[model samples]
Target: MVNITVPQNSPSSSSHYKSSPEGLPSPSPPATIKPSGSGLVKDYWIRSTTCTASSTADPKRKRQLKVDIPVVSYGHSGWLTSSSLTTVVEDPWKEVEVDGDGFSVYCKKGARDVMEDRFKSFVDFNGQHKQAFFGVFDGHGGSKAAEFAAENLYKNILTEVEKMGEVNIIKAIKQGYMNTDSQFLDLNNRGGSCCLTAIIRDRNLVVSNAGDCRAVVSNGGTAMPLTSDHRPSRQDEKQRIESLGGYVDYSRGVPRVLGLLAVSRGIGDQSLKQWITAEPESNFFKIVPEFEFLIMASDGLWDKVSNQEAIDLARSFCVGNDKLQPALACKKLVELSVSRGSVDDASVMIVQLGQFC
Candidate 1:
């Protein structure tokens, strides 16, 4: 364990970081806002200072779907797993139930590859929020970044949410991403990880993405993309990079920041922090009755499968006595991608929205 303790911060904690004039833009309330205090949301308490208020903020694969963006080419000489003299532990691919009843999850580490992916799904997590919290972190270079993110991202987001007392989902989620990136940078961790998280509360489905890992929702069997993959080749992404005086290099079919990291936004990669950002693009929508299911996975699955195809396979499993076994459907998705030659760690979390009361 990397001793995942919450780093203490004071409102005037200059020692924590040398201030930047652009010192992380203050987080803005999510695009859509609903007045707080609905019967569905339970009030939660948070210490006033657990998280300092400062800024707000806040892929894949395969084939050539309508989106022509290239999948990451696996060449990471520029990045290292960990600089410490310790051997990184490898986790095997096995389906485990992290949460149940309201949701089902299935996750596996890639074969022969130190599992760089981590996931979480909790209904009424930590006795607060009284809603489902889910996420998938895809790590490159090492599992440290992914592990760290899995351990802390939710806490940070919740802290922000608690600060707002569930007043704003978007800002809380955005600050969560920013806080995770800042905390990781304090360790000067050399690797980076992509993040995709979905917070379901008040009948609202809010999703935020910081890299290529993805979140998709099935509305009446129609596949709807919830977050945009943050890749350098996207015209807007390239513009953002160039504007920051950071350029993207395409020596490989994929674009890399400074010819190094593949994704345009992520949790760490301190070296490319200036060019790449940890801020996320989030989408918030009222979960309609048509919302049947949601699938979030690392690029390993996304690279070889299309959004609609993945949803179709999931729907196929919704038959017979196994109708509620979404975890099995998740494992099947991973198997299908590996069969198709996915070359990275595969992880998937399936949320049967209809199952939620």
Candidate 2:
């Protein structure tokens, strides 16, 4: 194996990308850094820098390759913290939560030096008092893909609905995912993101997911999953990849696409576009009294907490004649996930269905 040195940046360094007058931040540094390794080393750090190859085996003889590290500055409150209405410094080891009317969101960074998870919550969407949207994006490789999706996905859906007039809500959502993926690809960005989104319009609830992020609703305290994770371990996904000339390797104790990414479908990931997809699995349900609340979260929680256990705990804090602190429920869940040895970023949002139903 070729040894490579990665330049590390402090967390506070993200502040260097402050927003410009156009509401977009300055571009990231060009990828003209020194070349350090062999062919494999060139591919490992493709996200932030480019590498050049030499026919000789000498590292000193390799020519340096230059590229641009795609900058995702729009709609970012910071590198780690995200809130639709307000900004808060995010701390993985401490409570970082946001409370809104009938909804609350909590996000905690993982063991990684940088948090890659981003979320969105929009209420009174497009002048419609009853319309709302919520989403959670779990990013891997880099945060650019997740931040891009969180900023543009729902807006794309809204644009489609305005043109199509909601003739088919599901169709609009699908288009949104497609547009977001295509646009991010044009940026030539590395990495990808798993997304879970919930859209509430009138008395209808539409849920969609492209990766491991999940959505669960409580029907009278019963947990009902809305999306199935897209992993290579699934028989159908494995078959699909094999049919497309790709293979899943389980040698690392997790099924990965070509022994790389564990997720089979996500936004961005241009290198693995042939094997993975951005197409989301979507479902619809009519809001009813039986539906008590909805939970949208990243795999950080699911890796350690069972669905029923999460539901039961959330119910204790929220389900009653007089609801307790829904925000507290969100905090408790994230705390539990971290306490259970989850070193991944945990983000959870609790939406009380009674307000919409």
Candidate 3:
């Protein structure tokens, strides 16, 4: 384990993490702001010391400036309080012409000191109001696998789409996964697998699985899973791995690969990659505009909570006043997972489609 210590700044100290302009107040107010909807609230706290000030003249004394105001902002801090959830209205797809077709994303890293997990990207092409959304990478063995997927999977898929054309989306998705896996192998000896699912042209969704991470779409309040869980215990996966010269170890009847890894497929774990395959197992579904919501989460979440349980929790929140359903759902999922004793790092992304979109 690598120890990374972040230096703490004293409230009175003038370090970069807590520096303000001369004459400005040190330490700014927390970033936590209430959500616009009723009974829904979101909050964030940032530790910093950059403040802005304004002066006003006293009513009785025309020549006297009697009021002093200080506003502070900082870039970094030691111990900051942040809500487990975040929602953004920005265009992850960066489509300008499409009015209401932009992407909405919500993310939360549950209960961990650091957010090592990553999320899929939703991007909109300039002319395509149809939209493209992807839940493409699930990191395992370490954060590197997840981070790499979050950062590059969308771009890789887009590139593949461009080269192969939309008629061959399945081919494009498969090639993209294989290419991404190879890239990870080349960059770092340690690699991870990804389970990718995407909504294309706002009509169909394609799912590709390589690891245990799961993607599920809520249809009329019922949970419909979009991808399969690729575990070594699965008969077909075990046969494939064995055919590739890989052996499964069963210690006390609990099966594991090499007695350490559990999943049958992944992008990294170079030592295991040779035995493990990167070829994605895929499925496709036509999306109904009336679909309630979509949930993508890491293994930490699924390990502790059932798909139906997560779906019910998200459905419960959907009826409330929270307009930021995605973020709220993610927060609730994380909380529930922690409550159920999920010690590993947990991350989730919820995407909700409005009727207008």
lDDT values, one for every candidate: 0.63, 0.68, 0.53
> Highest TM-score, which number?
2
What ordering of candidates by lDDT runs from best to worst? 2, 1, 3
lDDT of 2 at 217: 80
* 26-94: candidate 1 lDDT, tens digit per residue: 322212111123211122221110101111221254322221111111111222121111111112222
Residue 129 CA displacement from its true place in model 1, Å: 7.8
lDDT of 2 by residue, 1-357 (tens): 112121111111111112111122222222112212332122232111101111112357454333222222112122332212111222222234555556777777676555667887766556566677888998777667788888789889888887777868788888889999999999977677888899887888989999888787887887777777787777889999999999988534667788777788989877789987998888888888888899898888877777777889999888884747777788899889878777777889898877765
- In model 1, which runs have C-alpha deviations exceeding 4 angstroms? 1-99, 126-130, 319-322
What TM-score would you give candidate 3 relative to the actual structure? 0.66
lDDT of 2 at 95: 32
Rank order (by TM-score, best first):
2, 1, 3
Per-residue C-alpha lDDT of model 3 across residues 1-357, encoded as one tens digit per residue: 111121111111001111111122221211212223332222223121111121234568554333322111221122233222222222111110101122223334333322334555443431355465556354454445666665556567768988999888888878877887778888853436456555556566666667776777667776677767666677788888788887877644446666556666767667676667777777776666656777777666677777777788887766445553545567677778778666545656565544314
What's the lDDT for candidate 3? 0.53
lDDT (Cα, 0-100) at 257 in candidate 3: 68
Number of the top-ranking candidate, with lDDT as the measure: 2
